[model samples]
Target: MPQFSRHSRRGRILIAIGLGALLVGTSACTRIRTHQGYQVDKLLVDSVQPGIDNRASVEGTLGRPSFVSQFGEKDWYYVSRDMRALAFSSPKPVDQTILRVRFDPAGNVVAVDRMGLEKVANISPMGATTPTLGRHRSLFDEIFGNIGAVGAAGMGGGSGGGAGGGPNGS
Candidate 1:
């Protein structure tokens, strides 16, 4: 009986160690979740010199911009985002960057600007219901409002039936 207990105790110890290791591995993986976009390098961004790099050179050096301005063709934007999420929660922004490069009419880089996460704005609606100018109506009101608005087909005037309103003489 003493030998059997020793063997069973050793088995239990091994099982506990395995279970602990598995849990640690899984939790580590959950914390390591990271999402990246653009992945711009600081050296590459600094290499782009305004008034010196044209569109072709800029594209060759830093690849292509993430997006071009909709209103102005000469403006380009390089956007980067890094997000981290643990388990099932929504990913939170760890880092974000928006590099705006403006070009002159001649296609030469005229200005370079950078914006960080500090510039981000979150907008929330003020109330549970949006206020409007028109009167509020329920489903019953909308369905029954037009019930008495229509008349019988012949009760109203027919085409060209008014006094002295025909093509020929009355």
Candidate 2:
């Protein structure tokens, strides 16, 4: 009957609209995964041997390192991170790897060390103001405190005189 068909059409349209809304909502909340820094290859990493592999061989195998030590013995660092984020939130590290290759004076590999997220440190700043050792002054005190300090007493100016003594320096 015509009445039955009309109701069926309406139900189908409502179902389609509901499905479309659900698809969009889920897409918005989908997590975005990203990789940063060096990409490690297990086989290549395993091939590198201490003493046997020199700086040139290691560089050829792993490419350039992320950073090198600034002081003390020369060391190369390969840092990697896997991050994930949802919606408009900032990305957070899901996994991290820090590979350190130590080198001797002769540029030969001394040791190879690998570290995970356990070594990561989180630091939170105390507040907006930095703690400093000094006397605290109010707004009014800071503004007017030094008003008369310019030429006052042993400030190296006015009354007590200049280089040769007196006001004329004679």
**Cα lDDT, all candidates:** 0.84, 0.91
After superposition, the stretches of candidate 2 with alpha carbons farther than 4 Å from their true spots are 125-133, 152-170
Over the stretch 62-106, how does candidate 1's per-residue lDDT look in tens digits?
788899999877898888888778767777778889998899989
- Candidate 2: residue 52 Cα off by (Å): 1.3
* Clash list (residue pairs), candidate 1: none
How high a TM-score does candidate 2 get?
0.81
Q: Which ten residues in a row have the lowest lDDT in candidate 1?
A: 152-161
lDDT (tens digit, per residue) of candidate 2 on 45-155: 888899899999999999999999999658999999999999899888899999999999999999999999998787778989889999999999999998889977887
In model 1, the Cα lDDT at residue 128 comes to 97
Best by lDDT: 2
Displacement of the residue 101 alpha carbon in candidate 2, Å: 0.1
Candidate 1 accuracy as TM-score: 0.70
